[model samples]
Target: MSSTHAVNKTIQEINEKIKKGTAVVLNAEEMIDVVRKKGKVQAAKDVDVVTTGTFSPMCSSGVLFNIGQTMPPTIKTSHVWLNGVPCYGGLAAVDSYLGATEPAEDDPLNKVYPGQFKYGGSHVIEDLVRGKVVHLRATAYGTDCYPRRELSRDITLADLPEALLLNPRNCYQNYNCAVNLTSRLIYTYMGPLKPNAKNANYATAGQISPLFNDPYLKTIGLGTKIFIGGAQGYVLGAGTQHVANPERNERGIPLSGAGTLMLKGDLKKMDERYLRGVSVVGYGTSLCVGVGIPIPILNEEMAWFTGVSDEDIDMPVKDYGYDYPNRLPRILKHAKFSELVSGEIELDGKKVPTVPLTSYTRSLEIANELKKWISEGSFTLTEAQEEIPSN
Candidate 1:
């Protein structure tokens, strides 16, 4: 059977089973076995949904707070700082955005500690979610109705009536492998890449990543429900720098940059275990986020996509020694996730070891938990309100 051939099922049919509480749902790990044993046709007929998951450090994550009005002399905030990290205060008088990678005022990047953003935004957000006090400072332009020049206070999550984890880019559809071809070691967000391709680091859950299963964003878009940092979340929009249409493989999986999702969830409902503040040595700090998405097996095509294996998913390996942030990276080679996960891959006729930054074990746990949620009727699949951009 051709891989491109369409499957014989409809979204309405899947919704009917969901409505009747008769839908058959499986996690990505479970679907792998089912597809292997029963084949795609039979598996598609048996499964109504497949849940996918990933837990990795995403620097593009952030939190938004709607702090209620202050005491007398209510000020229209012009400058806002949370735990000494400058937050975006241009929204409303009481709104701010605390970015994950935003550094502290005293620890500004310089020649001494270049790119080392130690302890600032992400930590403050974590503290707030954990019900700890965080120092808040704000300066405002006085107004007749809300007259105050400055205010300083310590606040907790309870002080804010509304707080949300609004990450612009949470789960990447696919990512490139980082390898060091030079003689010296390289420090990167993907962890440390050894010299001369001694070891390669890739950050992805492979078969269980949300966007990996729905490479084209077919069934994932605005309003899709997800498991974010161990709490229920929703896809708000296409994430920043979301590469819509990209080069794909024979299995229709993206070879490189593809779709991304902007997720929003209640911070109060999140658990600290799934939302840890991580500081990469020599690099900046980041928030390790755990995200899971239940892909509705609306049709056999969707089922087939969920059944994609590591061997079928190919990703490019880039030279981390190159100026990746400022310029396009030099692609050293292209290898499948299976090859990368095998602990070794051939690069320039030499075998190089590899490591994974994302935890497959945690990903499996999240997927299985989500599977239980769907089976127990605690969670239901949601249809995307709009198709994600393909640009």
Candidate 2:
């Protein structure tokens, strides 16, 4: 490495440059070209931060809120339901969580044939974020210290003391490309899959995705600032099902839903555009959350990792109709993102069309927006308070 290319830096040094408005920030797409043209060493010397983004329906996401004290100002809330959707009321007081995947209590869960299943916790959350009124109904076993038993009221997010976007597991580092091998169609969280390998579906922004840019999570960890739901958020920790060990390819990238993140942000500041409710046919309801993470180019290695391209990332394909539902998520074949983006993948020697569940266009917007904030000295990367577990 030449003197011009071989330069080592830190998050603090990058922060100083960001503060001075002299930092050269780039999105993951641009970083790919920079690394290709100038090489990793030169790219590391040139770029300070690389921004990445992903917008997809993640089921392991939800909103946590405190509807404030009811009339008597005392209610040991035991069971809470929002807009006919059952909420997790295990928390103290009027606090409850609306899980994105939780169905309504009286929901016609696929029992009514020839009808699309819709309306759930996710939709209720979207309504709140959009400033629409949400009906709140609760019941509790009367206690001495907190006596009130039953409470019912229509409340908006504005009525709450705090509404938080608290996601347990999100941004699965890698995921499956689902297809059906059986003779009939199958609807899954990945969306509707055509039978006989006619169509396949995947969800990821590829190279520009957050975890893809920092595969090893070298700089992304606890307390790392991020662009989430069109607002600033922090990484809480390694998300649920997150484990350090996983199967990796030659490039050291995981082959499954390996690396994950727990994230939190102020729901009050979130934009409805980035936080949306979606219902998959026969699958369930889910929240589409837009998330972006900026990686400080601390060294040549960081530059190289951020330059990961679609062609280089491979995710395994699974038969959602046959293998997936039977507890055997067998990898029929591994397909490249480049191929998936091309709208087709050759599965079982058949040319199957591919569909993406996430929006790359929205992802680009988020990355660009974050870049703009950083370049304008409005955003600075945070040094992780704790490391994300990785091997």
Candidate 3:
């Protein structure tokens, strides 16, 4: 055969192999019908609750935590556990599981779950993490800005067991994620900590570090380490110091408090527009900001203690608490639970190690569908085709 013909034959063989590889990996689980994406628990029963499909954001949920200060200036610690574990542990757990090999038992976060199917709470995992329970407080001319007592909580993986046997068929069908914040430092860009300062916050370095100094803070950074969330400056507004003149008194202008001073450098980042607000935690001695994700606000005392920078993506805060906060409660008692496990693995009196249908698997299947959709649109690595149904 001619050299050209031989080359063409070799090319054909290579193309055939590529097609075979893409066809299917028999070992990998295949999904049939699933709904992927985040959603809210719309209704509740005993075993499972319903939520909107990925196409809707009405019920999407996220979380945040305050790591800026050791103790918030004026905040309180109220209900600690809200269905899940501490904010820091949650992040660490998810990252660990995603990066783990067969989910090792040695991982510190592995003990967070009581059983494979149980949800995590602060009471079970607080002892394993480095954190404190203190109240935070701050004042605007001696007046409290926002007041809400909260408990700063954390947790680890020894908390959940069911993760190993994740429902496969419908894994991505519906969204069910638990996000957490850790010492992972996100980078930020800002002019300086103090306004009109000739020197930068870090004279030698231009960037802020991700680690906070607080013992509760999990990640550790050096040199350029800056905490993620914390209040930097007092809102400043100035008025006449003394109205000694009779004309000033007649005008009803006795004087104004020091002008509100907002630190111009750092900006707080939140998940949605609704989560723009600050809360007092650590028993009312600290202040940290929280967004709509319903993450705990770390007291400013902690933020300052950690030397967090405002430019970090993890610390974005909405101005004037102008945005709405996540209204979803940590645990909606009204949520329904379908497919309640009978512990015997028997759905209607048949012995089985596992059930065929599971919400978790359905959620994963949905995610795969969305991935296919992205690839189909030629927006990803997959060949161009058509959009997959996200609903």
Candidate 4:
């Protein structure tokens, strides 16, 4: 081979650039373009950009080349690890049931009722009051590789990550707001299609009033409790959302971040829902008292990675640092989206592209640094910089 043949390949150069902080991230197409420019005939290109940010709710931001999308490259796939297990991240149906009903008085005793019965809904049961639900869908892209629906028992108040617990009062306040909103949306605003599973007299629409007319309702076997139950799968789905906040921003303008993620399956059972509202709403409250972690701030002393004894979670969010708070979630979301869009887990180095994200999530309550970096394509390694020797 000629002496000129002894040159470095493009990918190797790019990897070195990444390691040295020259390039933030590069996708397949861009990597190809960079390789071609290197004057190398067959340089390898393995890295793929998970996605990009079009517009973000966090301080208005967008990518230059991709003018219209919410995030760049439109995050095709994402992954996350929950409880030490790597799971693909995408849009899963985050739902909760209104609860079951029993026979009520005034109605004649029927086979379903026990002597003029006392009717109740799932939410009415104090034991099932916790709302943190898990919605894991077995898909082709999950880290496990095999297809299976994996879910966590009910998520208790203790299961919360501290980033959410920034200000105990504010965290609680946020929880209340989220819970109240959930109660109103799921119960009052969202009604059952058919009342009593029938369309007959007194059945204009079976509502929650039979119990106490409480807007808030919970599901049985769906509370923040632990139960070893098997999971099932159903149809796959997709969705999108955009909003313009008028009360906060000075522009009085409508800014939005619109993107899509795949929902692996329908809610075959209560055990497979995200229980999103409940989880966010009850973070630091009495609901999560002693079982798991608490709401966390973007940065806090108690928050660190798994090996970092200063904290509890094996992979705490603070490890990623505040600069990347959203990194983990973004990666997980991307992995899920990729599976939805392509039907498999995308690779990033030896990992499944998602391991980093999940690992990062467990790093701290939130990595504001990672979040900013992904959403805005910018982040300052302030913590690391502070520790660096000042020359």
Candidate 5:
């Protein structure tokens, strides 16, 4: 067997082939078919890169805005608001962080509107990115050098020197399917859960997930370029609560939550369709982020990893009805994405329908789009500047 460091050599070979117009690249879906027809050995020899992608509701997301100078008498703002939702004003006078799930201060729990977070931080960011004027208000104590007490203005993304969607946590490697056994329906970020185990809702892009294809974080790390919301982006680091260690099957696929990514991209270049403002019933609002990462087929092992089928990826089914304050929910059973996508799974001797909160169709579109970019030389792979933590 070749040393794992062969990845560097493979990168050089791919670059040389690209210059000669002889490189072979494929998306995750197409690579799966090729592997199935020709086996991993031959497929690895033919394919140089495989693109993977996902589109899921990421709650631990936000945007950082560096709103430029406020007219004269610049005040070191102590408080800031974006579309009625309070933002982190601790950064400098004109910098703030707008969280995805943060509701307006007047309706913290969505009491008045109940689930329809009409003007939350995510919506404010979306409006600004779309070139719509967004309400911005700030208050500060008077200082000798900067003595402006309050300021209010309408601003678009272009008005800010830096408007970046820096999501601390976006796509998760794998997630559990949630089911409620209680008599009443419960709404959650995982989607609506029906009573009496009537339905199951899950959120993940199964085999097409970027971290899943690169479970060990071999090639995906800091500085890796990616397609984010139809615009180019890069990996910042390991996402918050990134579980470097998790129970895995024989194929090294995590059974549940595992790797995650912290991504950042220019909001001004993002498309509104790929960055959507979502309102979950009873749950707060969030951003459905579309992310695509191209995995360089460094070797045969990498090719096999990217070609993993949905049926081979297993995740647990957890009962959301159970309350576990300090512990995790008891795993009822395991089911594959293929089983969930089939629309049903057998649990406790009963057939229960399944619902996917993430859009698989959109995920495929992103992967194909990324593949086209690489094939046409519009996008090129970059080696990770820093490796991610595996432990």
Candidate 6:
């Protein structure tokens, strides 16, 4: 906890400013311009909070809710399904979790690799948030206290009082741009990859992503309030497969996938637009969740970090055609996010078309929304109860 610059602020001080309607907040994109003009030291003194955001396909997202108890309170559900998709029913008799990637039990290609998965948990989540009709079914072993063995009903999200989004991993700090080196086309979570490295796809909002703004996770940790799915949410802890230290440049910019965040929020308060379900032609179902975090300019160093531009970020290009599936340790190359967003990049002396699984447009929208919330004193930053681990 040391500072490299001669400026400092605190979360408490920022919250006081929020209460007094005096906090100077900016989104990550705007912070770059401020840094360019005023420099980090001046920017640190001028800006109180910098907000970052992302809207991306997160396979680890899901919701946990307690369906209303059956009549006579006798249904001890042992299995559960929503709109033909299976849900984890082991939590409690009436509590269950629906994973974003769980294919519908009735999906024709549910078990086939590289199959067209039309619907799954993400769709179910969207339906719940949209207030659409959803069918609920369950089966249980009858007992003295729980006499019901089977149950079925049509329900909506409003029927559940404790529907909490418990995403296990999300908002990747950085990510690989996937390409196919093989002669034939391939389908992956990154999307379709044309044969022979003709196309590339990536995910992340680059400089605007939450963890990217706080590269070291110094200010983000347990209980940190965040903007998630258009609702107020909290950081639960480190995400699965989190990497504290990855390859970085001289400026400490990570050139590969690094840290991740686990988030939790009440789904009932979420906006439907920020939580859409998606299905890939050959891949499976996934949730496109919006996430935003406000990073306080605790020091000049923090301000400098928040000013990271797309040009400063580099990400690895990997071969999903072979290396990825084989778990081979190889990087095809590295490309700047600036170049990646330009819709194309050169690899192996060839121009390859590029796309992003994460929506930069939605990301900016989410960031601006958070900025507005802070400006209106409707949101304030929180000090982490515990710091996120690096390793």
User: CA lDDT, every prediction?
Assistant: 0.83, 0.90, 0.19, 0.19, 0.84, 0.90
Model 4 TM-score is 0.17
- The C-alpha RMSD of each candidate to the native structure, in angstroms, is 2.9, 1.7, 28.8, 25.4, 2.8, 2.6
Give the lDDT ranking, best first. Answer: 6, 2, 5, 1, 3, 4
lDDT of 4: 0.19
The TM-score that candidate 1 achieves is 0.92
Give the candidates in order of TM-score, highest first.
6, 2, 5, 1, 3, 4
lDDT of 1 by residue, 267-304 (tens): 98988767878777677778988898988876677777
Tens digits of per-residue lDDT, candidate 2, 205-315, equal: 999999988888999999999999999999999999896888887766788878999999999998899989988997889999999999999999999999999988999
Model 1, residue 106: what's the lDDT? Answer: 70
Per-prediction backbone clash count: 0, 0, 124, 60, 0, 1
- Candidate 2 residue spans exceeding 4 A from truth: 1-5, 70-72, 108-111, 114-116
Residue 375's lDDT in candidate 5: 84
lDDT of 3 by residue, 151-247 (tens): 2333232232221211011101111111111222211111112211111111000011111121122111111111112111111111112112211
State TM-scores per candidate: 0.92, 0.96, 0.18, 0.17, 0.94, 0.96
Candidate 4, which segments miss by more than 4 Å at Cα? 1-44, 48-255, 266-360, 363-391
Off by over 4 Å in 1: 1-21, 71-73, 107-114, 323-326
